[model samples]
Target: MALKFVRGQGDGQAESGEGQKADNTHSPDNKSKWLVNYKDRLYRLSYYTGVQLMRFGKRIRRHAVAAVLDAQDWLLEQSAETRERAAYARISLRRTLEQEFFSPVRAFRARVKELRAEYDSAKSQGGDQMESFLAATSQELWAETRKVLGITFNYVAPLGAAALLFVTITTVNSFSFGLKVEYNSKVVGYVRSEADFEVAQAEMKKRIIYEDYIQPEDAVPRFTMAIVNDKDIISTNDLTDRLIESSGNELQEAYGLYIDNQFMGATTDGDSLLENLNARLEEYSTGAKDEKVSFVKDVQVREGLYPLTSIVDLRNIESELDKDESEERIYTVQKGDAPTLIAQKYDMRYSDLKELNPEIETELFVGQEVLISRSVPFLGVQVTKTVTETEDIPYEIEQVTDNSYNEGFTKVSVKGQTGEKEVTSQITYVDGVETERIVLDSRVVKEPVTQKVIVGGNKPLSYIPTSGGTNNGGFIWPVGGNGGYVSCRIWGYSGHTGVDIASQPGTPIYAAAAGQVVTAQYWGGAYGHYVKISHGNGLYTLYAHNSKLYVNPGDYVEQGQLIAAMGRTGRATGNHCHFEIINNGRYLDPLQYVG
Candidate 1:
């Protein structure tokens, strides 16, 4: 047996005696008697166990080492393959052992141990039975181990028969048995393999422990708040009183409701506070309405006048109306009011109000009444005037005489006189002497001199009729006269057609006839302080270059009623009214219509 062991160790050195000699130093002693005795016992035991036993034992040990090494090598091969497939698969052996094998070892341990026990028991049993049992056990072990190793093994013939039976049983068991895992009523992980089963079980256990140890009181709920409206409050009692007055409820119910010092609504307890308050507010709001009064104040005289040709009056009606009307209510001039005052009160255009009382004059009197209506129109104009006068002129006259000779053999002389004239002259004598003479002539031509003269002066003029016109009746010219000069004419350009009326700046432009205002605007585009009135005669009058307008869009206007004060506006060379008379969709010269 010692020789056999030595020979086994020296098998690679058979050709090198020197190598054998060197190995001998590390070898077990052969000369010692006890060593010899132990060797003899070992040899007898080997012989009694059968030559097959000795060979089988050596084979078993060799196979065991080879199996482990092969499993490791297979694992490495699988890792290399996995790496080639996906970069993330290049896991370390330690990680693989923990995740794929050790982690799942608990789930698979029972079967593995059973297989191992069966193998050991079969080895103890003798003959054909042992071979069959070992084969079955090895096959079972391989199946369990293959999951971790990613490899397979083969069995001998007799063993193969038993292995087939084991495989059948194992497959059936695998299909029938499974672990179920649940999380928060939802399934997140499934475990069919031992590795996966073990990991899931561990994770579940850890989560259970954490949940059991934590306290609910340690966590707090989150909250957020916001302020919807903020306003100053002068007094709580005042607010409460207002709420009570406006609300159809008692003081207790009205304690919390007010809108900017006015009573609005009532509030109940928290449940229906908003609902009740809103309802009360709606009722209060409905009660409020706007009331407009046609205000008139007499013109106050300051104890002097050239009949008071000019006067300044602040209407104060607008401010009063504004104050009397509810915030939610709109106040419009119904009748008998000046558009300028109404517009000033509302910060709107006089032209906008002009539609309400078209016959109203630009030169409004304190006692004259006009209408104020609801439709707030946008028509604003600014009036500005400048007056200038000519300086004093002087007059002068002179006289003159002339000398002449005619029809004489010896210097016959003649003289004649001409009518009133002024002249100065000088004559030269052949003796280097000079004579001076003067004459004057003056005569006023009284036969209605027919020389053309521009009729109107440069001073600004207005055409507002002073009498015989009202908001209802069509306007009658306040002053009797022919229409002013045809200073300019209307034409078409840039696909636009309109007329330009050249009058002195600050001319009072009136509504051509009874009409409703359709467009009233100031300072927008080419038309400045412009107004368009629809006369129902298939005619409309356009007035532009106004320093002021006195009507609104929807009000009825009478013919020849003052609508605006003419002045220089967009594209105007000087102060003049750009007037247009449209009849049947065609523009006629204002000169043709006005007269």
Candidate 2:
């Protein structure tokens, strides 16, 4: 039989004429034929023998299976000369394809149109040199166009792209834009969201209240918010709280004070008010003051983040944030207790404490129970302020002495008159507690009148009763706390008529040597609320600046009996009792008899 190569057959195709039907069993290892069919690397149908002619021509100039039929028909109809010329054209085409390259892009339709237009223009001008130049240009353009077309249609390429982006180290990622806050050229904090920035700012304000103590408008720190990309980002976690704490710490110092389970405000100081007390406790525990001064009860000084007021104005702090966290506590008076001391121990004002307990005697008993409260502010900051103010200046009294009068008697030759003055003073206060003062300028508006007195210098020794020199044995100490400090000594200064004994308001006053309540009402003016008593003896004891009086005019109060409470009423700025021991309507220093 003659050897032949043949293409595989499709279903229902007639068998070849002189070939007998092969056996039904086909071998997978057959060199020329196989039973199975599959797709080849060219993505064409492949039999055991060869590949299918489903696609033809350049892979770049993709042609369908149907186009191959036309190509084959054209080839078959070409004469020898045409056929050979076509082959040469194909060779040149392949050379162009191999020489140049292009990315996947739009077809070079512009070049085709350009070439055509140029040809048309040259043809209209009718120049051989121009025509020849255009022909050459056309040939070059043809190749370029084919290259573009090749990439556009002959092959599938992925779209390549590029982009431009801006990044910076001063940015962060968040739902909203970033906010950067700077203070005195230093970056204090950053926030991603607007809400977080607000919170951060609010927290920062705590320092103003707690530390710098400046007005809100005087706050030097500032904030800035802007947009940023992810690449230039940092974190904003707990950012508000962190910034708040950071700023507050920078502004103010902190301390805590405690006393044998009780705290006293006697001699404590702080950068603000609280720290001094707390630090005193710390010092006492460490033996810095007096180690031998042991704790009367609980002997431990607790360390804790004692909350403080914010640096912003107290009014602002109270209004800006919620203070649902405040609590009220009650304290019982222990031995050696006074209203002022109790107020200081609980960190409350003497007047405020007295106001809280209006029913209690100004003087306190050892077992007396009083109500005191501690309110923890939101931010642990105390706002201090420097304020310029004009205040009333008390006129001075100048005394002129004459040696022409009798010994125990004096005459006012010229009456004294008060004057006015203009004073510019700088007052420093923390949370409304005055700490320091400076007088910037002062001018006396009205000159004060000096009192000329004819005094008994050495005239004669007058007969003075010796009976008024000693105590009647019925008096007792009235105010509490270290037995009441004689802040203003008896007639210690000019124009001071009586002794001002300092004590916390609400401290009790006793009936000096069993007296009758001659006057006990709201005595206005500098004495504030006061009480007067007639001892029934030739002498009388007057207790001015009493916050409350338990006795009526006709009521008899025994020695050491609680008759009134100490207070800062009328013209008084603080809690103290102005006491006087008088005989025959003559005022004398109470200390003389009390001592």
Best by lDDT: 2
| Cα lDDT over the full model 1 | 0.41
Candidate 2 lDDT trough over 10 residues, lowest sum? 1-10
Question: Clashes per prediction?
Answer: 48, 33
lDDT of 2 by residue, 255-359 (tens): 222223222211112333334223323433323221222212232222222224422332332242234236667776677565656777878766677666764
**RMSD to native for every prediction?**
42.0, 33.8
Query: How high a TM-score does candidate 2 get?
Result: 0.26
Total residue pair clashes for candidate 2: 33
Model 2 stretches with alpha carbons more than 4 Å out: 1-321, 324-326, 332-336, 340-373, 379-389, 423-444, 457-459, 462-595
TM-score of each: 0.22, 0.26
